[model samples]
Target: MKIYTLEELQEQDVKDVIQIEIDWSMAYYGKEEIYKLSQEISKCFNLDYLIINLKGNSIGNEYLGLLAQNITKCTKIYNLELILEWNSIWNQGIQKFGAQIQKLTNLINLSLDLRINSIRKEGALYLGQAISHFSKLQNLELFLGNNFVREGAVMLLLEIRKCQDIQRLALEFNLNSIDDNDLQQFGQNILNFKNLKEFSLDLKQNYELTSMAQSKLVNQIQKCQKLTCLKFCFENIDQDEEVYQQILNSLYKIKRLTFFQLSI
Candidate 1:
């Protein structure tokens, strides 16, 4: 079921709708509007999968948390994709969002895009802790691009250790001020995700990134002996052909890797 506009949120029966997609991206909505939307969404008691796009909606922080809480009323949700990019949902918003969604203990896959929001370390910590509560999570994609996580990004990884069932993961922290030191620990934490077979990490616009750091991280990633697919992205790196060749050589050592992509 697809609800394309807020006007379509009628006070009607939709309890049998197992899957719902609300595409409201780039639409303008205020606090009151979101609250009402939450009320309507909560009535979908049998929802098993939801894909809501509120990106660029100019929605503020105060109501998104409540929306998160209301969405969990479905109880049967195992897959959720919430896109809140280019909004003003700051740390407080993410904290509320994260805390409320932890109630979905059955979630197996989640894709949360809070890009370009003014989130800091505290929000990252809260979000990570909340996500760690999901014992059944396997596929996860979190895009916190253009925020201020920095070293805090590592905290998210540390918490992700709890979801050892993760097999496919995509984390984008582009323009997050993360440097080599932060990713070294980040690399170490991900190595323990023994079930991880497909992984994508995007560090584009992380100006401090260098070939050396990338090499080190690749070395660490290779330790995930089960990985068959890998993708790495970064800003154009200044390196000689030999340096690039060496990096490629290191990546080639991952014998199980069937698909490899490195974008510099």
Candidate 2:
């Protein structure tokens, strides 16, 4: 494991380093303090990826959102993985600090968690729209069961398809009102990604509807000659073993395949 103490981080001037991680598990030093920390870190590292963790419950999301805004100013930041829990305060924080989230155009990968039960669907749509503006974003992970708009998510995927730079996608859906047609359309959009290599779908409670959704999905996915890794989880397996074996055998022959997983 890689560990850096605050004192150690303060002393090392790794100006050419491409990755940095900051863990704020201590007390809430507020936005200015966090901004100072971000500036210091940015000065020391020419970063391509950054992992920021607000470890303790000492601060609300507003402070963290402010911190994120400052960090986006780092010119070398291209990938960001943020781990945060949603609270009403944090939701308010993002709403108050609107454009900062949308300004991160260099970002290609982002991971975040929102408290689904509390956030309005409109809030999720706004965030989705913000993400769509990322010209280079290829991978996104959001943790909120039913808080996001089904069409917005699909729209984001369609938008990313237009970017033609996206290669990996992961989506998590709670018990939302999405049917086979939605899946079919989403699958069709994914096939348009000529360079796409990996896809993952996490649907919590739609097993019985998946097999009905499977044939179209599998067919569309198979059209991607460049795809190598696939992660799928569905509720039903109405197809027989022999037929599945045939499909698997043909899929294994794809030129880019090195990893494959299908769960029913």
Best by TM-score: 1
Q: Which candidate number maximizes lDDT?
A: 1
Q: lDDT score of model 1?
A: 0.86
Predicted candidate 2 versus true structure: per-residue lDDT over 176-243, tens digit per residue = 54567567787788777777888777655643345546655676677788887887766455667764
lDDT of each residue in 121-158, candidate 1, tens digit only: 88888889999999999999999999999988998888
TM-score of each: 0.95, 0.71
Weakest lDDT window of 10 consecutive positions for candidate 2: 85-94
What is residue 144's positional error in candidate 2, in angstroms? Answer: 4.0
Q: Positional deviation of 155 in candidate 1, in angstroms?
A: 0.8
- Give stretches of model 2 more than 4 Å off: 1-18, 24-45, 55-61, 86-98, 113-121, 138-143, 146-148, 174-177, 207-210, 235-255
lDDT of model 2 at residue 211?
59
